[model samples]
Target: MSRQKTESEVARTTGRLGPAERADNWRRLGSEEFDVVVIGGGVTGAGTALDAATRGLRVALVEARDLASGTSSRSSKLFHGGLRYLEQLEFSLVREALRERELMLTRLAPHLVKPVSFLYPLTHRFWERPYTAAGLFLYDTMGGARSVPGQKHLSRAGALRMVPALKRNALIGGIRYYDAQADDARHTMTVARTAARYGAVVMNSSQVTGFLREADRIAGVRVRDVETGEETEVRAQAVINATGVWTDELQRLSGGRGRFRVRASKGVHIVVPRDRIVAESGMILRTEKSVLFVIPWGNHWIVGTTDTDWNLDLAHPAATKADIDYILEHVNTVLATPLKHDDIEGVYAGLRPLLAGESEETSKLSREHAVARVAPGLVAIAGGKYTTYRVMAADAVDAISGDVAGRMAPSITDRVPLLGADGYHALVNQADQLAAEHGLHPYRIRHLLDRYGSEIHDVLALGDERPELLKPIPAAPNYLQAEVAYACSHEGALHLEDVLTRRTRISIEYAHRGIDCAEPVARLMAEVLGWDDARVAREIEVYTQRVDAERDSQLQPDDQAADAKRSAAPEAREKLTEPIS
Candidate 1:
């Protein structure tokens, strides 16, 4: 019988199939060719891997770093149809995105994605309100907007009543529209895990050093185990390049004429205390080239993102001074009480892998993606928004149908619920009873459900066994100690950063940046990963330096100056030994 995959089963499988297993498998790749080998474990790559595997293809997905470590995780956390795309007359894009959004919320990832309301404040007296209202009316009638509440128009007095933080003068009136929000990092990781569950041999920290070729035809790849610095050849029938901004680098490694240029646009976001921005719904403000969103995260407000062209380090893009200033200036215009540098609790920067169209403005460049068969055995897909990743993956997989030689199943991802999605509503209904049994407040259980969905029982499993793990973490009380331990043991979190930054939001949610809780969290992780005191200290030090560098960058005068400062910080050191071939 195929064994049911439990939490422990998942952990054991991942630990056993780490870097060493990666190397051994790579060495045998050419001898036992995979049906498809996917490079880049971002959302698109992960989604693509799942699509191919579900269709009965033998697939292997490799990433140089963590999954969703790139643009996928750094989004505005919205699964939205670009309402602004309508202004540019991109009706088709918005309709498709809206349909996908509806699918995700109602059927696919119901556990992870939820509806969020946004207030579009009209500034001008006469023309703007009617204009904005007409657009929103269209938005409501479009594909799946009906899944959410329809638009609500409010007068200036009514607008201020809804969003008391806004100055009365800022808006002539307002219109509320519906969209969906997601935990981007969590969703991306779940996508990768879903792909793994479907039989994709998903491995991270396995870097592709070069492409494998059989004469003129491209074949597979020469991959390095980033942990051990060992290399092996992973041969496949067809390879897909979904490396986002690293597409050019992958092409150079492949030694081919690269298909299309990918230009990186840097977007920076600042997080402040929730009390600072008093709004019932999120706000969207227009900018010169793009738009800025003051999105509400739990207990915090996320105000960002300045969009400008970037030519900096792809792995860790730094927010320049200009980026920060631009955001502050635009946001300040609408706020009754302005936010200063110290008022900011956290800052983050991400790069958008936009297809470098001939347009001078990056914002005007199409968000639509392109899939190109660059070589006989290779295909590369790039340039799309996160909301439409599934469609993009399906398209990329469809491109390789000729080479696969078998009748393949249609894309089932739209119908395949993520791991936690099934039975989520039923679990939600029983959360109160579960919370009382577990000695947690009902709110806590609800919180766990939102983050873990039905898999919350797995998290609670550790607590049930060890009552001590049920207590709140010392410095970061929002998280339970069991959560910290679970991340390392189950989520492939090798280092403290992975646990703090990705697995949990302590790095961004707290002003201390988890410094006070680092050692305790490290200790909790140590029990599972076998880290000693010295190792724990080193991890803490590395994380502290990273936080310090980010803080220093935020103080710089402009993007150039901020990037220089941020880049001065040491590069991330390897935590595990590279694989041995």
Candidate 2:
């Protein structure tokens, strides 16, 4: 694990995450000693593993669920410089985030993160436009927002041309600004894959059950695979906890008081079809509580989100009736044609781990993250924006690198492009030719290239012998059958829910929340995962119940009621007997 990487070894760039890799990593975790063992598989954890591995340190990143299965996947999916933070006068945080944004946009992850425009609708005519413009000007200059175009001012007529769905009197004018957007789940998974390419043992569905200690000094972690129920002792010189909202829970297991407490705040979003609100670009509207966004998705417009205090299940933050109603009520005020319940396609909820501070409301809580050496050889980082994951990761590893022997290297992640980053633009240029070679349309080839980048060949290779995989999924045709197969074979998807929910996003992208495709997707996963008939049936049952629970939760009036309803669905993985160490 401590061997230095060589130039010819770049073929490892695929960063494949399948059952075979997981099994090999599990065996390695039991036998080899690591320089750092990172908990949680969110973006921060994945970034930390990359930071450690790139520094020539042996590292392993473990997660209880799929990569980005938590808050990382359910973000507003923007790499903006925190336009709202500017209002709070948090110049430094915004500046740091913008720097990371430019890094992802220009160098690190161009394939996943792309430029997106948002129109800030004006209500107060002269005052609003100037105020917003000044704020945007500062945003542009603060962190080198040069990757995308600067802000553009528009009159009412021009604004209507931009978004025809707006009520005639909704806004007097508007200002358009640029920011980057990404499929958060895909981006996080790529980061993990990149870390693996650099020789980090990255595996999902591996839960850390307890901390390992040697005479009161942190030694390593006791991990259990959620899929196989196999426990292993993974020794490390240092351990990093990047569990986000679950920070407090892990800290308690360490039997220590944390440097700061984390508070959970629930944010909910609803997805509707693209035609629901006719718009050339996304829209941003002001609300008394928080800002509302109508972001443009591929074939849909994502409208959301409501921010409120949450004291329920962190894993499954349920979106109640009131939450969806609040969003519709606010967005309805300006819409020429108000969206109805039937127009809704999907709903999702994620909990933000805000650093608990002196704030009366969760919305006003601090988002700036804090890291601490909770104990000897143990480090924990909690609370930060999604766009600044790299910075958060650098700081986490910086705290523990002193414990590793020899001269520790500085962070080189700024120059480290993700797995699909190399040759992405060139492949995009040859999309038509690639389509011809693959017997598909140019648009489909372009889509695959954007998602898989240079690794598009690996995905396409899955269907070389089995051509039917190149066809679309019967239930959710937007995604090809090969995608479902690749989810298990290359993306570490262990269950049917993981395939529909995180890996491919058939859950939120479709109207049925992927229920119709549950059986078919499960069957495909079974082929790769070696699931029996009973296991396949259970996977489908768990997924169906999960979908039903979410719908039931959305109908509830409050958090407590919604949580109780949502928790009714059983976990996809059944509890196994004591793990064979």
List the candidates' TM-scores in order.
Answer: 0.94, 0.96
Highest TM-score: give the candidate number: 2
lDDT per residue (tens digit) for residues 313-381 in model 2: 888899999999999999999999999989999999998888887596877776788999989989999
> Can you write out model 1's per-residue Cα lDDT over 412-436, one digit (the tens) per residue?
8888887678889999999889999
lDDT of each: 0.81, 0.88
User: Could you tell me the lDDT of residue 190 within candidate 2?
Assistant: 88
**Each model's Cα RMSD:** 3.1, 3.0
What is the Å distance of residue 14 in model 2 from its true position? 3.0
